[model samples]
Target: MADQPEEVRRLLEAIDALAAIEDDATCASAVTALLNDWPTHHARLREIRQERVLALRDSGRTWKEIGDLLGGVHASRAQQIAKGLRGTKRPVKGADE
Candidate 1:
């Protein structure tokens, strides 16, 4: 893929290496290694995405536009990401409250 990041390339290579293993023990070990390392990679990826979303917002892009570019994520959700808010649901304010 064009312009793929080095981390992503390494991840793909690791996946390929995992897939090529025929020995069950080796496969298990590889899978364990991947699982062990996944959280760090996942966090890094999330941080990168948040940074990009903020950058896009700062570059005169509307949340709706960013959401569209992000494969139809809701504008509010995109805004939350740009603001570094986790996707946790909060109680809505009702008229009675």
Candidate 2:
């Protein structure tokens, strides 16, 4: 969090607050809602990551370095993921239009 943007830090703090709920039924309901909407968030996050990966690639970062940053995924897989996301049209933040 020391290096993360303020928005990211706040979001994490909010999530942590939600996770700290003590009521059983409330927690269950919250978990249910999260699970129901998780796929949408998951997809959006993947799209964002793919855009970032492509931007990193364009900035001269090697595929291997990107793979290392992305949890040890192989360079080939990272390339494939980036290619797949090209059709999504989600641009990286602060990247060229």
On lDDT, the leading prediction is 1
Instruction: Please provide the root mean square deviation of candidate 2 (C-alpha atoms, Å).
Output: 11.7
Model 2 quality (TM-score): 0.66
RMSD per model, one decimal: 6.8, 11.7
Q: Candidate 1 at residue 28, lDDT? A: 92
Off by over 4 Å in 1: 1-17, 89-97
Error of 2 at 59 (Å): 1.2
For each candidate, what is the lDDT? 0.88, 0.84
For all candidates, what are the clash counts? 0, 0
Off by over 4 Å in 2: 1-16, 85-97
Whole-model lDDT for model 1 versus the true structure? 0.88
> Worst ten-residue run, lDDT, model 2?
81-90
Estimate, for each residue in 25-81, the C-alpha lDDT of model 2 and write its tens digit.
898798789889999998998888889999999999999999888779888878877
**In candidate 1, what are the lDDT values of residues 1-97, reduced to their tens digit?**
4577797799788788898999989999979988999899788878999999999999999999999988799999999898778888677779458
